[model samples]
Target: MSSAQYARIKLGNQDKISFLSNLGTLLAAGIPLLDAVGSLLEDSKGGQKKVMETLRADLMQGKRIYASLSRFPRAFDKITVNLIRAAEEAGTLEVTLKDLRDHLQQEIEFNDKVRFALLYPLIILFVFIGVMLMMLVLVVPKLTTVFYQLGVTLPLSTRILIFASDLLIKKTFYVIGVGGALAFISYFIYSHKKSFVLNILFSLPLISQLVRQIDLARLSRSLYLLLSSGLPITVALELSAQVVMREQTAKMINRSREMVLSGKKLSEGFRTSKKSLPTIMTRLIEAGEKSGSLDKSFQEISNFLSYQVANSLKTITVLVEPVMLVGIGLAVGTMMMAIIGPIYGLVGQVKFR
Candidate 1:
């Protein structure tokens, strides 16, 4: 992947989460920081081991964990590092790490579910493409030979198929080159054109809702974590924006931050933002503000959105699987008919003669 690709990737790493979870456990067991680091270092290997050793060295030099973590921004995002800094200062490192561990676990699980849900469709698509290519490049050529040998006037469909097969078999390198270039250009455009990508994403039907729910879930959970860590609301909102994946959602968050500074409540800003996030979110935020429990309210909203994300993904999987299968079947059936029908016609003419 290019640097732009890495820049656009979601925050958090599974290995970092495992490390945080284990570190928290060790800390809770009353182990000194140095010994814990050493033990972890002993068990580590490869690039992760190198990072751990650097961290251990930093600790040995009397630097803080968050300070060391800040050096590796790719692995530990600003939100995670700040949370650890706050926990370190407030003397709640164990609890903070555990909370972070839980957050990372949820992120990992969500990503895994999405990958699995999409995997089936992708596999089917690849298989369909493979079968189609084989028929076009291999099967169609043989039929084309037979039709030419018999001097039969091929149907329009067969002629089209023959033309396509000629392109596949004769212009093979040109096709591959064009495909490779398209893939690269697509990646570049998608990574750089944030607003374009967001607009396209939100224009889709089911996908639009799914994207919004997932973004809302992430933002709510981020706010809950940051606010619960004793950060000011403004700071929390700013940091929470960085944790979300969508560019438009991040822009809305920044807009809400500006609104908060101009004497508007966070709930009002959330309600009035361009996206118009769920009404229930604003209602609960209002209630939480009145009761001085915004953290809990945000957590509840996060939980609800998480469930919605899962349900929406399941619904998409259920609908798309059958549609894809039917589409493949129809495509293959059409191609077979196109290739075979002319041969049958030629055979009948021969028998009549």
Candidate 2:
């Protein structure tokens, strides 16, 4: 059974890369695959060691490395397994493992760039929310009690804040219950593709751009690796399409793959896929086609796209932090004005009377 057919345990990406790199190095040094697994087990601990030991047992049973690795779906994802399969068939398992390591490293780099870009703004947002919530829950009630005793005529903004504070303080359990239920329902429906939220998110301009770039980079990199490992163009496209998380990009690729099947050029397929694919990408693919160096072309395209994604992430971070900060500032300023401005007006009225 393939690893996908068996129960698999998820391995950390860094750990997976380390193990694969070690295995590749050992294989290059003329060790048998079985001995390589044993060597990996010696240096490994915890879940990684267990995964290697399982592979060693499977290797002892005369299974090909790819087939045995495939059985652990958690340890080896489909892309890794397929690349290994192609490499094994082509007698390039060692080189394939090295390539796989490089592929994963690039992926990690891309993801880290994106994650770091969003992390600062998200943290700021959370801190803003927490501070606001605490003030509403703790400070608002006491100040409101003083206003009530003093017979101060509260403004509409103050009334709204008071109501919100009541909701958070008096109905805390109900608020939690409703929020938790809504979150769970949303996640379930969205994950199952039954939620309009998913469709809406995919259609947003900023999200759409980021998704397309990321998916394109991954698709090109995967195709390059699979093709370099001797996989057919059709299979490479098919497998890589599955790795592209964006529905639109995956659809574009599948359409392009069908075009390739129907004897149409892949570049033309991408250009006309009804998605906003970049002209430069289409031109690169055309160049690859013309030069009869499609794999090399894909590598270049992937590298270029990776650079673009990093730049996009940097741009997004630069733009979003300031915008988010301004919004938070406005929100906090409005809240303070609403709460304290009325009190000032009331004090003026008392002096006049």
Candidate 3:
């Protein structure tokens, strides 16, 4: 099989979640590590089976579980590998596995919610585009013929509509090809220049806040997980930066990490290095530091940011629905009035024999 085909068979996020949960449960039930892996291998298939076999063989050769897992970078990220390494040394593998499983599950749920939140706006845009296409292709052409037959002076709006309809009808293939090319170009730009696109997003008012909060939430959650798994604050911050979506947010986190590395307090580093860092986060971290519970502080921050994100998503959905409906209503209404106006005038000008 090609490398790409081989890659496809690797464990996905859900599969990894299941693996972790099952392994954690078996370990908690007092099963030996080797036996737990062996039992899991019975029902495993494809890449998972291959992984389990390798793990079992490695364990037989006296390799540690984390060492075996570190080999599958595609299946287990750096954060997972490092956490498992900590767990093995700390003798908390079962707890760490369950915690990791829950963390991954939470990430999946949050991502699904984010997708669902944005789904409405995309649906509205596509529906609006479809309405425009229908008007241009079907409705406007018939109206154009009527207006021509009546010999009435067409208003500017109607004339514009007619011109658009004519172009759409006469150069349909060209229009479609251009649209497809534009879409492809747009996708390419977004994929290659994600940071640039994200920068633009961060400049927008409403969306910027939402996007930032989402990234912050993810960063905080990652930090909480890493810290809970016994990673150092600086290391946690570095790994957390890698997981965030916004380049700007990641940069800010990295800056904080650098400051923290220089023997600065985590809260002080965040407050100094990140100008737009929320004051609440700074205060909470400071407090948590004083109490030696920085991980709990991050968990609290994650919860707060998640709440705000949920509210923001709800507000967007509530506002977008009415705005889209009203905008579409006005557009269609104006077009109908323009089409009907000239015909109405022509009917009135007709004289009885």
Best by TM-score: 2
Clashing pairs for model 1 are: none
Q: Each candidate's TM vs. the true structure?
A: 0.91, 0.92, 0.88
Scored by lDDT, the top model is 3
Off by over 4 Å in 3: 1-10, 46-62, 67-74, 351-353
Scored against the true structure, residue 344 in model 3 reaches a CA lDDT of 79
Off by over 4 Å in 2: 1-5, 194-196
What is the C-alpha local distance difference test score of each model?
A: 0.85, 0.85, 0.87
For candidate 2, what is the total of clashing residue pairs? 5
lDDT of 3 at 289: 95
Tally clashing residue pairs in candidate 3: 0
C-alpha RMSD of candidate 2 = 2.3
lDDT of 1 by residue, 1-353 (tens): 34443334333376787689889999999999889888888887755676688779889999999987776767788899899999999999999999999988888887787788889999999988998888887788887898899888878887888998999899999999999999999899988996797688776888878878888998998899999998888999999888776677888899889999999888878887635587788889999999999999999999898888889999999999999989988988888788778878987998999
Ranking the candidates on TM-score from highest down gives 2, 1, 3
Model 3: which ten-residue window has the lowest total lDDT?
Answer: 1-10
RMSD of 1: 3.3
What would the per-residue lDDT of candidate 2 be over residues 20-51, giving only the tens digit for each residue?
89999999999988888987889888768777
Q: Is candidate 1 or candidate 2 better by TM-score?
A: 2
